[model samples]
Target: MTDAPDRPNGGSSRGLWILIYCLLVPAVVVPLLVPLYDKAGPTLFGFPFYYWFQFALIIGAAILTLSAYVVSTKADARERAARLERRDRR
Candidate 1:
């Protein structure tokens, strides 16, 4: 098929990134704007509930973003390898 090679590799791990972003955006934003309903702990660096929540969210987002990047790259590489293998076998 002449157009077969032109077709895009349909396996995109971007969904994971999107999911992470979706979770993270709200995690970071919600925490800052709205305080936690129930929690009693001494504030760190004199930061209030909202500030602390935002700080933790940012840290969590960073970790998730890193994980997503690694996983997506690995998946893309694997998919590329499989495609190449199929092409070679043909």
Candidate 2:
């Protein structure tokens, strides 16, 4: 069987995975800290600060999730391509 080529740095993608996790952490963690937004002052369009903040968090989480999805999709594609190339070389 033919040997596959070696990639630089052992083909590690740990950094990209870490970045993806970082991008998703706030989306999961922020909303759980209720004390940060548990207030009634600073109303927005007749809504309390707490209500508006939660709405904003929903939008923020969606954007962050979408970004994470995009990054992971690209990473997965690259990994798949590398695997396929290795298989083809065999």
Candidate 3:
């Protein structure tokens, strides 16, 4: 067994990959939830459903970006704390 705290599971970080999958929800769900034609109703920029769909896409993208950032930051913090604890033990 290695002393490295980073490899608590036989050097396999499957949990990290699982975290990534969980973070992908907003990327997949937000666009589906946005009812562009029903919400925008008619047209806004002479683009029929185009304009509202684009807006929804942008909003969804922003949410997904934020979600990804939060997930990544949490993972980084967890790793940092773990490393700090390991250092303190040395």
Candidate 4:
């Protein structure tokens, strides 16, 4: 089998990663599925489902992104640091 190539960023690409796929869910899937929650039930503090759901989606997106970043940071700390070092040198 052919060996993996050394990447400038220090990690070789193994193609699509699941963690990266998760990063797209809140940004892509939620926005595309707006019809699913386009309702007026499930009120929150007098706010209708539409308004509250949007706010919840915003918070959910933020949390998902932060979680992904934290998980990825732990997983690729060395590779990311190396990439940053290379970038700053150029």
Top lDDT prediction, candidate number: 2
Better of 1 and 4 by TM-score: 4
Candidate 2 deviant stretches above 4 angstroms: 1-5, 8-11
What stretches of model 1 exceed 4 Å from their correct place?
1-42
Question: How would the candidate models be sorted by TM-score, starting from the highest?
Answer: 2, 4, 1, 3
lDDT of every model, 2 decimals: 0.62, 0.85, 0.65, 0.71
Model 2 gets an lDDT of: 0.85
Which regions of candidate 4 are displaced past 4 Å?
Answer: 1-17, 78-90
Candidate 3 lDDT over residue span 31-90, tens digit each: 666553445456766766756776767887777677777777766666666667678889
On lDDT, who's better, 1 or 2? Answer: 2
lDDT of 3 at 46: 72
- Candidate 2 vs candidate 3, TM-score winner: 2
Error of 4 at 1 (Å): 9.2
Candidate 2 on 1-90: residue-level lDDT in tens? 757466533474556688899999999999999999999999999999999999999999999999988988877776777777778889
lDDT of 4: 0.71
Q: Over the full model, what C-alpha lDDT does candidate 1 score relative to the true structure?
A: 0.62
User: Using lDDT as the measure, what is the rank order of every candidate, best first?
Assistant: 2, 4, 3, 1
Model 2, residue pairs in steric clash: none
Model 4 quality (TM-score):
0.61
RMSD of candidates 1 onward, in order: 5.9, 3.8, 6.4, 5.4
Tell me how far the alpha carbon of residue 45 in candidate 2 is from the true structure, in angstroms, after superposition: 1.0
TM-scores of all models? 0.56, 0.84, 0.52, 0.61
